[model samples]
Each structure stands twice: as structure tokens, then as C-alpha cells.
Target: MVENLTEEILEMLGNESRRRILNLLSKKPCYVSEISYSLKMAPKVVLDHLDKLEKLGIVSSYEEGRRRYYSINRNLRVEISITPHRFIASTVSETPELEIDEFIKNMENLLKTPAGSLREIYKALQEFEEVERQFSEILGAVSLKFNEMFERFLTEIEKEVEDELERLVLLGITKGADTPFKISEEYGISYMGVIKALKSLENRNIVEKLENEDVWRIKC
Candidate 1:
């Protein structure tokens, strides 16, 4: 069962667009237009990616009046393992003991409370501010972990590719040089060299050009 699920998860994650969609949905629930705008993808393309994610059970959606909102399935936690013979993928509950339903109910009750005395309103505001602060701290921790993982992944790639030019191009892209021309100009490398490195990176799926655009971006 774990092997089968791993294969399915790998197949679903093979597409860059789907992975991007999942990343966006993980942060917040969003409508198709919002996702399209954020990812610089066409609405139709965004919808297609969302469809695939929903089918894979990684994302779920609901219709709100005329718009549909999509969100990640936060309950599902994916784990990957690699060995000499095979790779394994598995899923587990992210927070099996956390009563998210009860927390939501409490939050809803707080939101529905009517404004009362000035002191009462001030206390409520203080509590909400504290909650916001806690959320910020949690988000900061997640961001830090993500950065560490990205750096480690880059280090592994650096080991596989020994060419200095390719490494420069990758570093440039990581630092926000989206186009080969920009990378060349910023790094003082020849235009042809930047282009050559970019092609190699694309072939290795390290970076990709956005559809209908001249810009290339690192596929993180």
C-alpha cells in the first residue's frame, strides 16, 4: 500500500504546475482567478492543475456562490523514504490529536460576539492580536524549515554538476535573475554561456521557462 501510494504521489508531483498549485493552496484557500494571478498562469491552466490535484486527494475545493475555493488537505502528511532498492512514500495524519473542528468552532463563536462595552472590545482586540502574533511565529518557523530544505537540495545538485558556469547560472537564478540575459548581465558572463547553462539546467529540470513568457525561473 505504501509503495502504491508513493508511486501515485510521485506521478502527481512530476508536473511543476501541480506542485506550484499545491504550494499556493497550502498557504491559503484561493479561487481559480487568484491562483492564476499569483502563479502567472492562465485561469484555464490553473483550473486544470487544480483538477488533477483534487483527483490525487492532495487538494479539495468548494463552490462559494459563483466562485470555487481550493485548499490543501492539511490532515494529510506526506513522507518519503529512499533505500538502495526502492523509494517509499507514505501518508500520515499531520495533527491527529489536535481538535481543529473545536478550534474553528471557538473562533466562530468569538467572531459572532456582539460589540459590548469599550473595555470588553479592547480585551477582544488584545486577544485577537495575540492570536495573530502566534500565527506569525508559526509561519516563521515553517519558512525557516523550508529554506533549510531548499539549501540542502541545492547542495546535492551542486555535487552532481561540476561545471562552474552551470553553478553560477543556478546561483544567479536563485538570487532572482529570472532570465538568462539578466543572469549574464548580472554575473558578467557571456550571453552564450548563460544560455548554454540555462539549457542544461532546463534539461535537468532544475529550472523552467514560464509558458508564453521569455522569463525562466528556478523550479524550487
Candidate 2:
């Protein structure tokens, strides 16, 4: 997987346009027109570079009708300087086939709640770190008392963090920008759930939401 990623990275960097395309996309997601305008290049030229980057998995694009938006592959770390280097990313094979009994046991563990040892449970949950990473920061962005008060609510914050996790995943907003009110309406999550999630995240020092407004920010 590392070898494949290295090959892809090298292939991606071989073209100047592709490198520029990554530079434009890294700031935020953008459509072809946006990239072309930003780089002062033609749309067709941007599209060509986008295709090459996407093919190498250095970038991923989503299309909405006649328009396509491109972003750097969140999973593929790209570092640009006088020379560019993209981290070799591992490929995930088909979800490792697990026996029915094993799958059921895994589900049972996930369902077990606060009863199990948190350290072990969290270790198993490491796979989800990237997705949940922002919540920690959100809790930190709030108030001090709110942060301390909330952490004590659960036996182990990790075991009960799921509802908040699902909410954030569904909210579809980048971290530290969107407010709780906006997220609740967009994700169909309750006002209470947002509060509770923020509280839980605060307890863990994962994020902080300002007292005056629901704007959330992740802790550094």
C-alpha cells in the first residue's frame, strides 16, 4: 500500500498543473471554474489536472450535475514546498471478512456502553479518530466551567460519545465554523442533543462552544 501511494504521489507530482491544482484545492473545496479562475488557467486545463490527481488518489472529486468540485484527498497527506511530497497512504482492503460470531461479538461490544474498560474500548475505536477528531476541539472552544462540568457526566466519555459522533458526521460542516443551531437543523438532531454532545465533548476537553452563542471550536 505504501509503495502504491508512493508511486501515485510521484506520478501526481510529475505535472506542474496537477501540483497547482492541489494547492488550490487544499485551502477549501472548489469547482473547476473556481480552480481555473484562481490559477488563471483554462477550465479544460484545470479539469485535466484534476483528473490526473483524482486518478492517483491524491485528490478526490464529487460532481453535482454539470459541475464538479475537487478537494485534496483528506486521507492522502500532501506537503508542498520547493519540492512536494505526499505521504504514502495504505489501501484498505475489503472490510476484513469476519466470522458471523466475531461480527456479532464486535457489535455486542459497541453496544455494551459504559460497562467496559475505556482504555481498551478507545483503542478499538482508534480507527474512527480522523472522523471524530474535531469534537475535542469544539469542546475546548466553549467556556471553562462548562468544560469541567460536562466531563463528569459520564463514566467514560469514550463509551458514550456515539450520539455526538453521529451528529457531527451528519452535520456535514467543517469544524470550528458552524454553530450548533445550524447543525441541529441540518442534521435533524435535537437542540438537547446538540447541547448534550457539546457538554460531553467539553467534559473531554475535545471542544468548546462559546457561552454567548453556539459557535463551536476545536481545542488545539
Candidate 3:
């Protein structure tokens, strides 16, 4: 829905004649005869088109001195998206104070939305920031809890594993060195030393060597 014929109606701009007539009215309010003449459309056709547009409530008419003038009524925006798996159409009425938060905001900040001169990106970022700021204490508590738990878990693992080399190899794998060669490079251990440590871990059921892959992972 458009509140202003002067403002852009976007995806709702239906046909060529309506577009031309609207394009004319956007510059200034126009009577029906002036619109028909300017657009080179017949007066009856113009009347029919205006009637439909008026019913949509985006165009409104007022009378003055034997002439009725028409202008855009309101501001509205519509968006449509199409893909092989999805089709979505959405409308947004003018909202000077709309707000948003949650997971969608974070994902949009990471991927979907790009910043430009548009107010949408800027407003979205501000809303996201405000949400994060409000939850800062909760976020800090979660981070600290994870750090404390991981440190305690590592300490227990260290007590269970006797050989220092086995411990180092386990730590390397846990940190993303899934292959023997990567473990050797990351821990600065000799390749044979890394292999020997891996064999000991496998025998103790502490880790497993993957079938058909030169990678390793914790047994569980």
C-alpha cells in the first residue's frame, strides 16, 4: 500500500499504463483529463485505471473548481523472492519505529544483508547491536563457563594419559590435527614418534584410526 503517489510504490506498480499515470502524478497532482492527455491514454481508460488504483487506497482524489485532482495516498514497500525451492512475497507498511532482534539478525549481519545508502541495513545493524548489548552479561557468563569446563576436562585427561607424547598427540588431534603428519608438524614431534603415540592411544581405546583415511579421532 502506498501512502504517497509521490513516494515509490515498488513491486505493486502493476501495469504500463498505471506506471505511466503514476509517474506523471508523482511529479505533481493531476486531474483525470491531464493524466489521460499526458499518458496518451483515452479518458475512459484513464478513469477505469484510476478507479482500480483508488480502490487499492494508494491514490486519492479531491475536487476543486470543477476538477477532481488525484495524488498518491501513502508509502508502502513490497518485496518478492524466487528460487528453485522457494517463493516468498512480503509487504511492509511505513513504520518509522519498527524493531528486530534474535538469530536472524546475527545471520543477516554475517551473510545476507549488505550495507549501502539504504536505511534498512543501518537500522538492522543498530537493532542487532542493541540486542547484543542488552545480553552482554549473559554472553560473558556462557563464555566463562565453557572455558572453565574445558580446562577441567583437559586436566582430567592429562591425569589418565601417562606418556607425555601420547598426551601431546591427543591435544594436537583435539585442536584439529587429524592426520599423523599434521600432528608431527603441529607438535614438532618426529613422524615416527607421532605414529608410535597414535598406536598406543588406539591400543588403550583412547582414540581410533579411521578406515580408508589417514586421520584419527577420539574414540567416543
Candidate 4:
């Protein structure tokens, strides 16, 4: 099994040249000189990008005498998780262990089944559709839980801080608007209002101000 290379893929694909190289390889495999001439980029740059792709297992290479060919396996799936509080990029496995043989068997009846049995065929189609509906329901339930957790976190913060400004400021921190200016801009509160709230929380040891930067965080 290949190791997880999500991070490497993200980093490697960030380069314009690497993206171009992958675009070229998607059409067909090529050697070093072939890529250089096709992309009009230097041979060294092509080699460097290919080297990184090889290490990440995103590109495979094989030698034909002195010439080496590079090709992309296209064995990748990207999954992005987005919520109000966080965003995550993950690489899902290229291959899934889905046991759909039973579903296929059920569909196989349509082969010999007469076209006059349209209603029967429709019923069989509904069975496959139910699978999609079940998956959608599960995903919807999981997404609701993310919001629920955030609301629960806010409930605890509300218990800790009675002032509305302080509560908003703390919530803003968790949302990554740690600086006073950012919090003010994000929540549409006045800049001075954010500063006053920060000072109040700081004096009460509810928040701490970091030196060198105008950043603040909820006191642990």
C-alpha cells in the first residue's frame, strides 16, 4: 500500500511548473527532454519537478534504455471538509471497498427482463436511489453536529463572560480573528469598542495580550 501523500501533493501541486507538468502528463507520458521541449521550460526545471513528484508517488517513472518516461497514475481523491469554524483538505483513498455486487445483481435482471415490465424496472431503480438518499441523510446529520459543537462551545463561553462585548471577542478569537482590528472588522463593531473590551478582559485575566503583535487570546 502507498503511504498517505496528501500533504506532499498539496505542496508539490502548488507550483505552476509542476501543475503544467501534470497537465502534460495527463495527456500522455513523456521523458525529460520531451517535457522540456513541449512546455518550453528548462530541462533542469522539468527534472526537479519530476523528482519531487516521484518522491511523493504522484508520478511514476520507468527507464527505456537511457530515456526515462514519467506518467501520472491519476490514483487520487481529494476530500474537503468545510464548517463555520474550520476547513480541512484530505486525500481519500483512490480505491474504495464498496460492496456493490449485490446491487449489480439486482440490476442484472433488467438484461433479460421484457421492456413491457417498465414498472418493475422503475422499482428496481428506486432501490439504487435509496442508497444515495441514505448517504445524503448521514452526511446531513454529521454536518449538523459540527454546528452543534460550536454552539455548545459558545454556551460555555457565555457562562464564563457575562459582557456581550467580551463574549463576542472570545468567539471571534476562536474564529481566528485574534487581533482587535480583525475582531472589530469581522463583527462590525467599532475598533475602539474592541480595544475597550479587550482591556476589560485583560485586566480581569480573562484574556492575554501577546507582545510584539497586537494579538490576543482567551485565557485558558
Candidate 4, number of clashes: 0
Per-residue lDDT tens digits of candidate 2, residues 1-220?
Answer: 1456655676677878777777777789899888888889999988888777777666787888887778876464333212111122344433555696697577656545345598767865663464345644563444444544545434333464566553462232332226767767766777787777777777777676667876776655
For TM-score, candidate 3 versus 4, the one ahead is: 4
Highest lDDT: give the candidate number: 4
Evaluate all candidate structures by whole-model CA lDDT and list the values in order: 0.79, 0.61, 0.78, 0.81
Q: What is the lDDT of residue 154 in candidate 4?
A: 88
- Candidate 1, which segments miss by more than 4 Å at Cα? 1-114, 203-206, 210-212, 218-220
Q: By TM-score, who's the top model here?
A: 4
> At residue 43, what lDDT does model 3 achieve?
95
**TM-score for all predictions?**
0.44, 0.33, 0.43, 0.48
lDDT digits (tens) for residues 88-142 of candidate 1: 4676655554587788668857655446988777877787788868876885576
lDDT of candidate model 2 versus the reference: 0.61
Error of 4 at 206 (Å): 22
Model 2, position 199, has a per-residue lDDT of 73
Per-residue lDDT of model 3, residues 36-102, tens digit only: 8888899999998888789878789999999999998867655443432223445566664425455
